[model samples]
Structures are given as structure tokens and as C-alpha cells.
Target chain A: MNLLLLSPDDLRADGSAVVEDRRLQHMLQVQRVEPGQQLRAGLLGGLMGQATVQQLDSHQAHLTLLLDQPPPAKLPLTLVLALPRPKMLKRTLQTIAAMGVQRLVLVNSFRVEKSFWQTPWLQEDSIREQLLLGLEQACDTVLPEVILEKRFKPFVEDRLPALAAANLKLVAHPGEHPECPRALGEQPLTLAIGPEGGWIPYEVELLRKADFAPVQLGPRILRVETAVPALIARLY
Target chain B: MNLLLLSPDDLRADGSAVVEDRRLQHMLQVQRVEPGQQLRAGLLGGLMGQATVQQLDSHQAHLTLLLDQPPPAKLPLTLVLALPRPKMLKRTLQTIAAMGVQRLVLVNSFRVEKSFWQTPWLQEDSIREQLLLGLEQACDTVLPEVILEKRFKPFVEDRLPALAAANLKLVAHPGEHPECPRALGEQPLTLAIGPEGGWIPYEVELLRKADFAPVQLGPRILRVETAVPALIARLY
Candidate 1:
């Protein structure tokens, strides 16, 4: 982990923290941290700074934190993604968090399998765990908000108008469309990416009607995990 | 598999072919092919077109090939990457191939663990398997050329200068460098990405001497897998 993340509960009143969970194990093993050594650290949903190892052992690591710096700015973007399968969902969650996405809407598309909705990875704790891993990877403290929309038509027709209004609404589709824009200069954007086989004609039309301009990334179709970063880099 | 890839051995002199492998199983189970069904197919290192199913059974599928169209144009880019861990290596290979990277050099770096070079994933057959999967994912027929550089300094000093000559040689480092360029319309580029912790100062200097201009991707640190696509999308 690039950053050692500590929750609010880990902090004592004196600003000292004792970590005894997986973070402790990671510090001891992967990081090979020792007493008196300082490492980059951040509090969950709070500030980021450094922590000095006061005491260390196999069971726990006592640290004195100096959380003075604000977390990195999140991307001014909202991602609307067709819920991927369970296996891909886990990695995509981490990827989204690491890439500084501010908001995410996991929406349903015609091609999304009904069984995908039943995955335990969608549980709050599971999602939080993956997001934490991503935050640690990117050394960021802020968590992105994730919204689930199981119904396609209602979400797009009823909610997406206001949700996408005033933003550069884009839907990444593969066809005869303009290339995805570049260097958009901090404009707020809402980008929708479809499932593996892609959004059906009806879904695309609904998105189009919702004001999402269809954009292409040339001919080579990339997986959602690959496409997310590519699109984000291009737009931002 | 988007495009069923056929090798030379799979084709018959009569322009028909029989396949009894994983591709056949995918055609039978995932694609659910029947007689007279046409699917997108491509010949390895050759043309891409349609394959009409002439016969099908549990053991094999026979098809008549009409290879005509050329594969998608490859990105005019060569990637120089520090060897990632085995798991990341597998995904990175697929990502490189899917994104149409024409050439790759997996090189050593100060932060790269020595064991990474020992991974079975570095084996020729294993690497080819992952590349094929990437090609299949992107529906492309051409395979990327992969080069392994176990020693860092020798390759960068003696060879990389000539290799990166005349191309836009860039080394992606997170620092006070200019942002990576965008949409340089078909200009060839050679991009170097370091390991997780990044290239040490000496290595960066060596690369600088070799004429690789340092570039940054903002403050947020991305995993190599994420960075590859992000950089490629931005450059091309």
C-alpha cells in the first residue's frame, strides 16, 4: 500500500494510533517498517500526512500521526457504468477509487446478466473494502460516492436528466461517432460506459435522449477496466 | 472471443478449416454456433473476415473462411515498461496487446524485484497466450512483438538511444515535467514506464541522456496497468 490508511476509531485523543489489523501485517511484512521510521499515512475521509512508528510488533504498531495536508482533489467526473460481472466488479471498484472518480452510478443495461446483481461484492462492507484498497494505492483519503440503479429506464429517463444537466454528458459507444474529446480543462463530466457486449440500441437511444453524446475510441474495443482510465485521462 | 483466430495449420488447401480446441469450445458453448451461422474470424498474421459454420459437433467445428479485410491499424507506439509482478504482468500484457501497442520492452528497474524476472509468465509460450487473448479481445489479427531486457543500464545506454531515435521518446515519471502530449496524429512514440516505486534518480538521468523527455500524469499515482492505457489514450 502506498499510503497507510487509519480510520477515525484508530486514533486516540493524543493523536496517537494503534493499528492491529491487516494494515499492521502489511507494515510489518510488505513495507518492512521498523520503530522510529516515518511513513506516508492518511485518515479515512480526513487528512493525509505522515506517521512515525513509535512501537512495533507482530500484533500491533503504535504510530504518532501528523495529518495536516488535505487529500488530493478528486476528478470532477461522474461515471455511469453498466454493472459488470462479479469478478470484474471487484477490480473495477478498486480502479475507480484509485483513479479519483468523484461519483459512480452502477446502472443496469440490457446486456448485464441478471445474476450480476446478486454478487456479494455489491455489499456495503465489500465495496468499502475495495475502495479502501484503491485509496491506499493512490494515496488519497476521500472516498467516491457509489450509487446503484437496478432499473435502466427509470434511472435514465427520470433521474439522469438532472444528474447529467450542466455537465458534459458522454456515452462511450463504438460506432460512427466523433472521437472522445481531450483536455477538457476541469469541466464536470458524466460518462457512461456499457457492458461487455455493449448497450443495446434501445439503451443507447435512451442515453442519447438523456443528452449523452455518443463518442468512439477508434476501432479497438477495450475492456471496462482499461476503458475507464483511458477515458478519464483523455477527458481530464 | 470477439474474433475467432485461426492459425495457418488450422486452414486446409480447399479454403475450409476444422478447429478442435478452446476456440471450438467457445464457439459451441459461449457462441452457441449452428450450421450456416457466420461469425467474425481472422487468420493469424493474415486477413480478417467471416467464417460460416458448415458443420458442428462436440469434438470439432468445420468452417468455410472468407478472409479479406485487414486488421485494425496498430498504434504507432513502442512501450518500455519495468517488469511488474507476475499477476500484473499477465494483465499488462493483455492490455498492451489490446490497445494495439506494436512493440514492448519489459526491462529491469531499481525498484523491480528480481523475482519478477523469474516469473513463468515471462516464458515465450505463456506470453504468447496472453497476447493472443488480448488480440481476441480487441478483434485484431496482428500480435505485438515483446522484448525482454533483464539488465537496465546496458539496454538504455547502448541500445535504447538508437531504438527510440526519430520517435517521440518519453519516460512517464511523476514530477515537475510537462504533461504528456496528445493527438500527435500518427507520429510514432516510445514510452517508458517505471516500476511501482518508480525509477531511481540515476536511471532517470540515464534515460534523459538517451533523449527521453520526462513527462508527468498529474499528482494521482496510477498502477502500471491503469497508466498504460491512460498514457496510450492520451498520446494517440
Candidate 2:
């Protein structure tokens, strides 16, 4: 873990914390941190700073925290993605979170298998766990909000237009389309990416009506995981 | 599989081919191809086009080849990457290939675990298999060339300089450095990315001596998998 993320419950009134869970184990084993050493840490939904390890043992690691610095700024983007397969969903969650995406809408497309919705990885706790890993990887504290939309039409027709009203709305599709814009300088954006087979023409039409301009990266197609970072980097 | 990749042995003198492997299974189950149906296909290291399914069954699928179109252009770049752990290595290989990176050098660094060098994923056949999957995903016919460097100092001091000579040489380091360049259209580039813990000062110094300019993505640290696409997108 790049940064140890602690929940409010883990902190004491005196600005100290005792980590006895996976974080402690990871610090002891993977990081090989010893008592009296300082490590970077952050509070979930709070600030980030350094923590001095006071006492270390097999049971727990007592730390005195100095949380003074604010977390890194999130990207000014709301990502609308067609829910990927279960295995990909887990990694994409971590990727999007690590890349500083603040909001995500996992919507359905015709090509998305109904079975994908039933995956255990979509459970609240499972999703949070993946997001936490991403936060730790990126050394950030703020968690991105995730919204699920099982039906495509209602979400796009009723909600997407308003959600994307003031933002640069884009749908990343491989076709005869303009290249995705670069370094748009912090404008709020909403980008839609499709399932493995890509958005059907009907879905594309619906999205187009919702104001998402179709854009292409190049002729070569990329997987959802790869596409997310590529689009984010190019846009901002 | 988006494109069925065929080896020379799979072709017949009569301009036909028989698929009796995973491609056949994918065609039978995933694609559900029938006689007289056409499917996108590509020859390994060759052109891409459509194939007409002349005969189909569980045992095999016979096709008439009509190859014409050229594969997508590869990035005019050579990537120098610290060998990641096995799982990440597998995914990264697929990603680089799909993103049209044609030349890659997997090198050793201080933080790269010794066991990473021994992974079966690094074997020629295993690497080829992953690259093929990536080519299939991207619908391209060309396979990327992968080079392995087991020793750190020798490779960097001896070979990397010449390999990166006359190219825009960049080393991605997470620290105070210039932001990575953008849209340097079609310039040949050689980029070096480090292991999870990042390149040590010594390594960075050696790379600097070799004439690589250090570049940073941002404050947020990204996993190697995420960084590859992000860097490629920004650079291209």
C-alpha cells in the first residue's frame, strides 16, 4: 500500500490510532516497517499526512498521526461506463479510483450479459474494498461515488442529459468519428464507454441524443481497463 | 476473439484454411458461426480481411481466406519497462500489444523481485500467446517484439544508450520533473518505466546519464498497468 488509509473508527480522540487489521499485517510484512519509523498515511474522507509507529507487535501497530495535508484533487469527470465482465469490473474499479475519477455510473448495454449484474464483486462491501485498494495505490483519501443503472434507456433519457448538461459529454467509440480531445483544462466531462462488443447502434443513437459526442482514440481497440486511463490522460 | 489469427501452417495451398483449435471453439460457441457466414480474420505477421465459412462442425471449421487489409499501424515507440510481477506482466503484455506498441524491453531494477524473472509468462511461447490475445482484441495482425534484460547496470550502461539514440528518450519517474510531453506526433520515442517502488536514485541517475529526460504524470501514483496506457495516450 502506498498510503495507509484509516476510517474514522480507527482513530482515537488524541489523534492516535491502533491498526490491527490487514493494514497492520501489510505494514509488518510487505512494507517491513518497524517501530519508531514514520510512514505516509491518510484518513478516509479526511486529510493525508505522516504517522509515527509507536509500538509494533503481532497484534497491532500503535501510531500517532499528523493529518494536515489535503488529499489530491480528483479529475473533473463523471465516467459512464457499460458494466464490464466481473473480472474486469474489479480491476476497472481499482483503476478508475486510482486515476482520480470522482464519480462513476455503471450502466447496462445490450451486449452486457445479464449475469454480469449478479456478480458478487458489485456488492457494496466488495465495491468499497476494491475502491480502498485504489485509494491506497494512489495515496489518496477521498472515495469516488459509484452509481449503478441496470436499465440503459431510462438512465440515458431521464438522467444523463441533466447529469452531463454543463460538461463535455463524450462517448468513446471506434468508428468514423473525431479524435478525442486533449488537455481540455479542467472542464467537467462525462465520458461513456461501451461493453466488449461496443455500443450497439441503438445505444449509440440514444447516447448521441443525450448529447454525448462520439470520439475515437485510433483504429486500434483497447480493453475497458486500458481505455479508462488512456481517455483520462488525454482529456486532462 | 475479435479476429482469428492464423499461422502459416494453418493455410492451405488452395487459399483455404481449417481451424481446429481454440479459434474453432470460439467460433462455434461464442460467435456461433454457420456455413456461408463471414468472419473477420488475420494472418499472423500478415494482412487482415474476411473469411467465408464454407463448412462448420464441432470438429473443425473450414474457411476460404480473402486477406486484403493491412493491420493497424504500430506506435513509433520503443518501451523500456521494469519487469512487473507475473500477474501484472501478463496483463501489461496484452495491453502494450493492443495499444500498438511494437517494441518492448523488460528490464531489471533494484525493486524488481528476483522471482519475477523466472515467471513462466516470460517464456517465448507464453509471451507469444498473450501477445496474440492482445492482437486479437485489437483486430491487428502484427505481433510485438519483446526483449528481456536480466542485468540492470550492464544493460543500462551498455545497450540502452544506442537503442535510445536519436529518439525522444524519456524515463517516467514519480517525483519533481516536467510533465510528460503531449502529441509529439509520430516521433520515435523510447520510454522507461520503473518497478512498483519506483526507480531508485542510482537508477534514475544512470538513466539520466544515458540521456533520458525524467517525466512525471502527476502527484497521484498509478500502478504500472495504469501508467502504461496513460503515458502512451499522453505521448501519442
Candidate 3:
């Protein structure tokens, strides 16, 4: 883990801290951290800091935390993806976290199989594990907000507009006019990618009306997992 | 499987065939083949064809073969990658095959752990299995040639010039001038991507001198697996 993420409840007074259990095992075994060395640590939804080792044991580690500043601001991007297979969903979340995305909305698509919604990875704890992997890779601590929407119409008609307001919104679809822009700089954006068979015509039209401009990633059809990296690389 | 790949020895003079064993299991059980159904099939290192089911039994399936024209030419691209971890190496090879790449040269990089080179995935037969997966995905049978260069200095100094002749060579590096092109049409191109932590400064400079343009995919640092898809999406 790049930054050991801890909740505010886990902190003790006097800037002294104790880390035990899984996170501690990861630090001691996977990272092979040594006593007298410093490691990056942070609050789950708060600022990051450097922690100096005070004591080390097989079961726990005590450290002195030097909290100073909050983590870097997240990308002004919110992604709305048609839920893919469970394996892919995990990887996409990690990738999104690594890219500094802080909000995700998973929705159902016509091409999405009903069976996919039953995957265990969609459970809150499972989802959080994948996000943590991404945060560690990016050296950040803040966990992104994740929401699940089963009905497409209600989300598009009732909720999407509020999110799209004041942001450049783009939806990735094949065969659209005016290619997707190459860079967005510091501006916030909301990008939507459809399921394997792509957004159905009606869905695309609704998204377009809701201010989502259609974009393409070229002619060859890419798998959904591959498409995630391809779109994020271009948009971010 | 998009294409059923077969060896040359499996072809019959009468153009009738019997497919048994692992492939038979996949066709009969996984794909649920039925009489009169047609599937895309190809001869390894040869032409692609259409196969029609004539009969089926518990052990084997009988087919009528109609060999047709060769597949469309592969993209004229050469990939130079730092040898990835064994698990990732397997998938990467499969992706390369599916995309119809013609050549791959695995090189040494600072961030590439020496242990990675010793992976069993590099065994000839294992590598072929990964390539077959790619071929099946693309409905094509042509296999990309694989090369391994353990020594960095000798290969870069001697072989790189001939490899880059008459081709656009680009290196996928972060924080570089002139970001990776979004599209390059059908030009013969050479693309390079680094290992987990990326190539050291000297390695990147060596590639630049060999006429490889250094490029970035914006500010987000993508994992090598993700970067491969992004690079291919931009190029092919």
C-alpha cells in the first residue's frame, strides 16, 4: 500500500498510532517495512501524512504520525459505466481510483446480462477492496463514492441533469459526429461508456438529450475491460 | 472462439475432418455445436476457412471443410515490451495475437525484475497457447513471431536501426513532449512500453536515439496491461 488508509476512528491521541490486523500484516509482510523507517499513511477520507516507526511486532506496529496536508484534489471527472462482468468491474474500479476519479455510478444496460447484477463483487466490502488497491497504486487515501442504479430511465430523467450541470459531459458511442476531444485540462467531466453491445439507440438518444455528446474510439471493437483503460487514458 | 485454429496435419485429402480431444470438448460442450451449423475455422500458418458440421458423437465431431481466402493482412506494427510478470505475460501475448500483430521483442529494463525472465510462461508451448487464445478472439490464424533479447546494450546498438527503418517508432513514457498520437492510420509503426515502474532515464534516451518518439497518455499513470490496450487503441 502506498498510503496506509485509516479511518478517523482508528486514530489515538498524541499523534501516536497502532496498526494491527490485515493492514499491519500487509505492511510487515508484503511491503517488508523496517523499524526506524517511515511509511506513507493517511485517513480514509482525510489528509495524508508520513509515519515514523516507533515499535514493530509480528501482530502490530506503533508509529508517530506527522499529519500536515490533505491529499491532492480528485479529477473533476465522474464516470457512469454500464456494469460489466464481476471480474471486469473490480479492475475498472481500481483503474478509476488510480486515475484520481472520486465518483462512479454503475447502471444497467440492455446488453448487460441480468445474471451480472448478481455478482458478489458488487457488495460494499468487495467494492471497497478493489478501490483500495487503486488508491494504493496512486499513493492516495480518499475513497471514491460508488452508487448503483438499476433503472436507467429514473437515473437519466431524475438524477443525471444535476450531475451534468456545469461539467463537460461525453458519452462513448460508436458512429457519432464531432470526435471526442483529446484533452480536458482541469475542467470537470462526466463520461459514460456503454455495455458490450454498446448503448441501445434509445439510450444513446436519451443521453444525448441530457447533454452527453457521443464519441468514438475508432473502428475496431474493443472488449469492455480494454475500453475502460482506453477511454480513461484519453479523457483523463 | 471466433476462429477455430487447426494444424496443417489435421487437413484431409477428401476435405472431410474429425475433430476430437480438447477442441472437441470446447465445440461440443462450450459452444454447443449442432448439425448444419457453420463456424469460422483456420489452418495454423495457412488459410482461413468455413466449417460445416456433418455429424457429432460423444467423442468427436465430423465436419466438412471449405477452405477459402487468407485473412486480411495484419497491421504492420512491431511491439517492444519490457518482459512483464508471468501472469500478465500470458494475457499480453494473447492480446497481441488477437490484434494480429506480426512481431514482438521482449527486452530488459531496470524496473523489470530479473526473476520475471525465468517464468514458465516463456516456454515455447505455453507461449503458443496464449497466442492461440488471441487468434481465436480475432477470427484469424496467423501467429505473431516472438523474440527475446536479454541483453539491452547489444540489441539496442545493433538491431534497433534496422527495426525502425521506414517505420514510425514511438515509446509510451509518462511526462514526455508530444503525447502519443490518437491515430496513425495504417502506417508501419513500432511501439514501446516500459515495465511496472517504467524505464529508467538512460533506457528511454537509448530508445529516443533509435528514432523512437517519447510520448505520454496525459497525466494518469496506467498499469502496463492497461497501457498496452490504450496504445493499441490509439494506433490501430
Question: TM-score of the candidate numbered 3?
Answer: 0.81
Please give each candidate's TM-score.
Answer: 0.98, 0.99, 0.81
Ranked by DockQ from best down, the candidates are: 2, 1, 3
lDDT of 3 at B135: 82
Q: Which candidate model has the greater lDDT, 2 or 3?
A: 2
By TM-score: ranked, best first = 2, 1, 3
Q: What's the residue-level lDDT of A182 in candidate 3?
A: 61
Where does candidate 1 chain B have its weakest 10-residue lDDT segment?
B217-226
Docking quality category of candidate 1 according to DockQ thresholds: high
Q: Once superposed on the true structure, which residue ranges of model 1 sit more than 4 Å away at CA? A: none
Question: Which regions of candidate 3 deviate over 4 angstroms?
Answer: A40-42, A47-50, A64-76, A152-181, A184-190, A196-219, B5-24, B38-58, B61-76, B166-170, B173-181, B186-189, B201-220, B234-236
lDDT of 3 at A174: 76
TM-score, chain B only, every model? 0.98, 0.98, 0.95
- lDDT at residue A45 of model 3 (Cα atoms): 74
Model 2 residue B234 lDDT?
92
For B34-56, candidate 2 gives per-residue lDDT tens digits of: 99999999999999999999998
The runs of at least 3 residues in candidate 2 whose Cα sits more than 4 Å from the true structure, single-residue gaps closed, are none
Q: Is candidate 1 or candidate 2 better by DockQ?
A: 2
**What lDDT does each candidate get?**
0.93, 0.93, 0.81
> What docking class should model 3 receive?
acceptable
